[model samples]
Target: MTTSTERAGSGLDDGPLTIGGRDFESRLIVGTGKYPDNETMVEAIRASGSEMVTVAVRRVDLDRSSEEGILHHLDPDEFFLLANTAGCYTAEDAVRYARLARAAGFNEWIKLEVIGDEKTLLPDVQATLEAARILVDEGFKVMAYTNDDLVAALRLEDAGCVSVMPLASPIGSGLGLVNPYYIREIKDRLEVPVIVDAGVGTASDACATMEQGVDGVLMNTAIAAADEPVSMARAMRLGVQAGRLAYLAGRMPRREIAVPSSPVGGMLD
Candidate 1:
């Protein structure tokens, strides 16, 4: 009798999430921000059961010896450290950051973000596409973070991105899955993995996002800002797995009218 805990991160259910020839058991990728402390961040990350932990490259110094840097606290052998161009506002800025980050990390994988506006924090898709092409040309595996637009997603993939990340909502809004149709449409249209990033508010949010049949979900504030981050991380783990499983199970069709269960033609008859 295998309990859910035993099977949670076992890689037995969801299988490996492959990005640019790298394999990951967990689909719940997380960020290294908004935690109260380094210890809490580490514990929450472990509890989340994510194989890859993404750090905002723009926010931290890549020098591993820097005690203040998040990399100093993380062991590369244990967790795959993914660098993201978090705050860069233009393709040039993101490309520069990506080059610097990869030089230090000795890896070409980068989560590219080129924010369009300070107020909404939505991505500048044009800049993101430009960065993706540049990074791809430089032999980097770019995972682009963009809005939920099918055309934009297709363009990113065409630009040679390894993965396309669509926001569930604005960053840190905790809005949950606001547009499942667009997400599903994007997933259906793209050959690359579609990871739903940002805007997941809770366990149910993560679950709902995954149930839309996207490859995975990446989140930060949802877990880090929780009153009990570790607990929330654990819940998010369950949520992601459950959602993936539910999607695999193939949900029953939706109906406009109620259908009775157990043959409702007078129970005694």
Candidate 2:
């Protein structure tokens, strides 16, 4: 497969939109998980040019000698921390963790996640929607992660979420997109920003989602788990830009017959 650089020319696409009153330069959001170390995560985030990065919150381990050191590596001023309620099982639990994030001085930007199953890592749609509604009403900019279910996505939007991030596949599967038609349909019906989160394996997958006209992408394992995390992050950035540009540029119509631009028999006639 051709690299994004080979497929798309060299240039930066237009910057991000001011969603929920936050000014993000790049539309590609990254997660700070599964990297080899904190330093590598920082490097990957830098290469990705992602202004918003996700961080998960769980019960504090009192036995550990030192703190978990998850967000300590990241410079808070430079990165907008999107704290996630990943381990929460119910809407109330997720809401409590979200409140904790706010108390920790990380603003109200949150990735609301309520897990229903451990095996599949699928979110509880009812719990997620409940948490999203509660968060939005409480003045938080909620970005709910859910299975690639169109009705669930619409429900989140109807609950007043600023953005709805539907998973392309299972969390951490690196499967790219399993059901793209649903994603396209969700994007068409929802007025809020639609982000393709989770299950993105390569930069091409990111580009494909953008080409489908989604507002943004939230990728994690694809970058953090890659052999060269930094390079993969950079590739994802370019791929996203290329995809967005292609969408805006308007694709050419497909034809049954090839149309030659060069004239035939012009020299010896």
Candidate 3:
């Protein structure tokens, strides 16, 4: 229940991550999918220390009373539910799912995704932008998922999306930050929060992604597919905190030649 700062103490206290006017103590956001069972998923989520969790409207069992339903397992009062358009391939379909979640009285925040390809699982920039526009017009806090490109990120921010989510690699690839430069560029250029979503294979990936100075990271497969999901989840929480702290501390300038720690004029021998 404690935040990264609370657990790490004053030195690591970077403060809460704010998205769409809501402040979450944890900067790591996680997805609810790919676990063997709901119990494991809940335990893993709790371990990750994430306050906001994503749910694909198409996949959730809407009957809140059902034991197997995500709603039953993840208490809405405990975690902020972010509805997403996971499987939708078209702008209209993505919009439909977003609207469906809203009609069901779920939260208005959306993790908008219009998948362009089935094999690659890349997002369709055009469809994603179109869907974001519609969702924003409808008063939904849209968090668009797109490839790591500054132009697309800028467009999404201009389209009134609450946050811009750029993939570290193709969805579920676990490639672990293929293009950190692009993520940095997107973060440097955008006004809204930038969250690196997908392509994180392990704790190091989450750490590396945060080192780019992004606002946060969103991942699923990295934790869910791990052999020890609960343990991996805890590791990821620490990784995110470590990376953020390292970034804030700042790294020394990269140099081609090595510098002696002791004064060069003084000889120990």
Which consecutive 10 residues in model 2 have the weakest lDDT in total? 6-15
CA deviation > 4 Å runs, candidate 2? 1-15, 254-269
For 59-102, candidate 1 gives per-residue lDDT tens digits of 45575546887767877788887899999999999999999899
Per-residue lDDT over 61-169 for candidate 3, one digit per residue giving the tens place of the 0 to 100 score: 5865456668878998889998889999999999999998887686788899999999999999999999999889999999999999899999999999999999999
TM-score of 2: 0.88
Q: Name the candidate, 1 or 3, with the larger TM-score value.
A: 3
> Judged by TM-score, which candidate is best?
3
Against the correct fold, how does model 3 do in TM-score? 0.92
Model 1 poorest ten-residue lDDT run:
5-14
Predicted structure 1, TM vs. truth: 0.92
| Each prediction's TM-score versus the true structure | 0.92, 0.88, 0.92
Model 3 accuracy (lDDT, Cα): 0.91
Q: What overall lDDT, based on C-alpha atoms, would model 1 receive against the true structure?
A: 0.91
Error of 2 at 33 (Å): 1.0
